[model samples]
Target: MNAIQALTYANIAIWLGIGAYCFFLAKKQSEMDRRLNSLILQSKTENDA
Candidate 1:
């Protein structure tokens, strides 16, 4: 393969790895948000009682 093609392939691979990391980070953030919301709702219910 040519040098330019190899360089492009490398760039694509790097982007793929970065995209995967971003996806997992977003998922983790979503989970944390859900847990936080649940905790807040629980507290509100407990306080109301």
Candidate 2:
């Protein structure tokens, strides 16, 4: 393959890698948010008792 074709494939691979990383980070953040919300609710309930 020519240089341009190699570069194009490399660019696409880099973008796909970045997209996968972002998706992983988003899933982690969502899990953390759910845990935090449950903790807040638990604390509120404890204080009321």
Candidate 3:
């Protein structure tokens, strides 16, 4: 392949990798947020009791 074609493919691959990483991070963050919210509610309930 020519230099231009190789560079184009490399750029596309890099962007795809970045997008996948961002998606993974977003999923983890949402999971952590849910866990934190549940813990906060549990604490509040215990204090009320």
Candidate 4:
């Protein structure tokens, strides 16, 4: 392949990697938020009792 084709491929790979990283990070943050919310509710229940 030519230089331009190679460059385009490199750019595509970089963007793909970035997208995967962002998606994983977003999933992790959502999981953490859910866990935190559950913990808060549990604490509140304990306090009520």
Candidate 3 lDDT, 1-49, residue by residue in tens: 9999999999999999999999999999999999999999999999999
* Deviating ranges (above 4 Å) for candidate 1: none
TM-score leader: 1
User: Per-residue lDDT tens digits of candidate 1, residues 4-24?
Assistant: 999999999999999999999
The TM-score of candidate 4 is 0.84
The TM-score measured for candidate 1 stands at: 0.87
TM-score of each: 0.87, 0.81, 0.78, 0.84
> Lowest summed-lDDT stretch of 10 residues in model 1?
1-10
Over the stretch 1-49, how does candidate 2's per-residue lDDT look in tens digits? Answer: 9999999999999999999999999999999999999999999999999
CA RMSD of all predictions: 1.0, 1.4, 1.5, 1.1
RMSD of 1: 1.0
At residue 36, candidate 4 shows an lDDT of 100
Deviation of model 1 at 2, angstroms: 2.5
